[model samples]
Target: MNVVITPHTLQGTVEAPSSKSIGHRDLICAALADGESVVDNISPSQDIEATCQILQAFGADIQEIPSSHPGRAAYCVRGGLKRQDQPLSVNANESGSTLRFLIPVGILSGNTVTFHGQGRLAKRPLAPYYTIFDEKHIAYTTTDGALPLTVHGTLRPGRYALAGDVSSQFFTGLLMTLPLLSGDSHLQSTTPLESASYVNMTIDCLTQHGIQIDKDWNGSYHIPGNQQYRNGEYVVEGDYSQAAFWLSAGTLGKAICCTGLRPHSSQGDEVIVSIIRQMGGQIEGKTELTACPSLLEGRVIDVEDCPDLVPVLTVLATCSKGITRIINAGRVRLKECDRLHAIATELNKLGADVEEEPEGLIIHGVSGLTGGRVSGWNDHRIAMALAVASQRCSGTLVIEGAECVRKSYPEFWQDFASLGGIYRQED
Candidate 1:
């Protein structure tokens, strides 16, 4: 889909979407439990649907309960992953979390299982799992380090060593699966873990389901074997990643009041508030944040732990004064799109000065941007970033593939419209 946005200031309040990261972990844990579990405050984006579909294919009966609140629902999952005699095929669509998190769990079925993925997911790295498979002598085949892989051997519990610089999803996969093993297991990080907060979310969700994992500051995790998941109710908090767009809009235009966000959440992207403030934006209120525009000045930010923020941060940087340098964002290139390059290329079309680096981006802030046509790169964040950046555009900004926002924010356009953004859809 295409969209054209005219220069307009966003106003009014918007409730943040439920946290997709936490939702993924909660659903998986609930599925692993022995009885039915209820997960509340879930927004069914494409990625969440992927996880639910795969879990259902594994024999967990998942039912969605309609909520009075729009765009949010509750899910009841009948627990336990059933084993199949023949090779079970699972399609992950484009969700990286589902593919990575379910691979180890699939091994427990003791039957050959093949994993299929679509779009960039097929090209994303899976080397960490390969390392584990090789170490344990578990048989598996992959199209290089990418997807459409098959595995059949039993996963043994022992000391599993993984490079911390790799995607945290791999660590989370092991953390979720190792506890089900008959023997105790140790997870040793070969390097300092990036995106450590995501692991914390994983640990938090696991604990909620009666699993215990011990961790040291040195990046080692101990999982006791023969652990059972406890069934109960889990509520997913508001997503900071989605809230960053509106908070950024607050800096570019009128004040945006974002509600339903937990200030003390473990989401690493929660750092968006501090980063905006550091760049000279104003944030007020507690449970509901009111971000008011200020004279934003560019500052250096390290995105090692918050790669998802790079796209929106680039938009914020474009409207600030001075230079904004984002470092340690090399991993972002492996996301749904090469985000650093995508942001630099797409935003530059709108007259923003952005330079892409091997591991990051250097953005020279301008007083305002000139509107032009841009591509979403089929990335949801990129699409949303372009839309938010449109607030300060001198002319109309056109975005191709704006529909990509449905990947994570199905109601993004609706919310954008509700915030007084002037936009129209096109064929």
Candidate 2:
């Protein structure tokens, strides 16, 4: 899909979409609980759907509960799965998060689980899990360290040590699955975990569902076996990551206040508001954020833990004064696209001084940016970030493959248009 956007003044309030991070965790926990789990305010994204589908295949009775309002509908994934001894074939599609989070938990079923993924997932690395399984003597094999892995796991509770620098999702999978093991399990990390905040989110969700995990600052996790999940209604909070685009656009236009966000959100992207504040943008209220019209100026932004922010932050970086360095986000290369490279490439096309690094990006602020045709890299974040970038740039910005934003925020373009975003298609 093609999308073009010209500078427009955003002067309205919009409700942010629910966070998929919290929603995915809540879904898995709810599925493992004894009673029905009603997940409210879910972002009907492809990634979240992949998660729900996996839970249903595990014997959870999932149903879409009709909503009376125009907002998101509630979903109930019934617990108490009737055990099926047959082999299970699960598709992770393009969501690497799902494959990592669910594969370990699926092992507890004692049924052979075969994973099939599409596109990038087919080439994405699963070497970390493969190595751990080998060390534990668990039966597992993969297709060249990628997806289509078959694991006939006789999950035995024991000490498993894994490197934490690779991806937090691997550790998250184990943390969520270990508690359900038949025996007490101990997980020791060989390195300090990267994205530690995400691990905390997992711990929070596990605790909410009645799973007891003992953790020390030294990176050891102890799981008490035979614990059960408690069923209840869980509300997914607004996505700070998705809200960053609108919030940034507000800075370029009139005050844009966003609702439906929590003051204390567990999402890593919640740092957007704080980052904006540090960059000299006036921000007010958590639920109703108002960005003051001001020039975005900054020296550096360390987005190591929040790689998802790189694309959107890059857009903000372009409008800032001085230089902006987004560091420690090398893992972004492994995302849906090489986001660091993609953002830099697109920004450079828009007449901005941008440089890409192995681990991050360096951006020298330009007095103004002249928009031109650019590529979205078929990544949702890239698509949305560029849309925000267009709001502040001169001339029209034409984005190829811009429809990719539907993967996360389906109504992004519509919302942008509703907020006075102006553009006309070339085709």
Quote the positional error of residue 424 for candidate 2 in Å.
Answer: 4.3
Q: What lDDT score belongs to each candidate, Candidate 1 first?
A: 0.91, 0.83
Model 1: runs farther than 4 Å from truth? none
Which digits, one per residue and each the tens of the lDDT, describe model 1 over residues 1-427? 8998988999999999999999999999999999998999987799999999888878789999866557798999999887776678889988999999998888875768899998999999998889889989999998777779999888788899988897999999999989999999999988889999999989988988899999966769999999999999888999999999999998789999999999888899999999998888999987799999789999899999999999999999999899999999999999999999999998888889999889999999987889899999999999999999999899999999999998899999999999999899875
How badly does each model clash, as a count of residue pairs? 0, 1
Model 2: per-residue Cα lDDT over 39-65, one tens digit each: 888868888888888888878888989
Clashes of 1: 0
Q: What lDDT is reached at residue 6 by model 2?
A: 76
Candidate 1 lDDT trough over 10 residues, lowest sum: 65-74
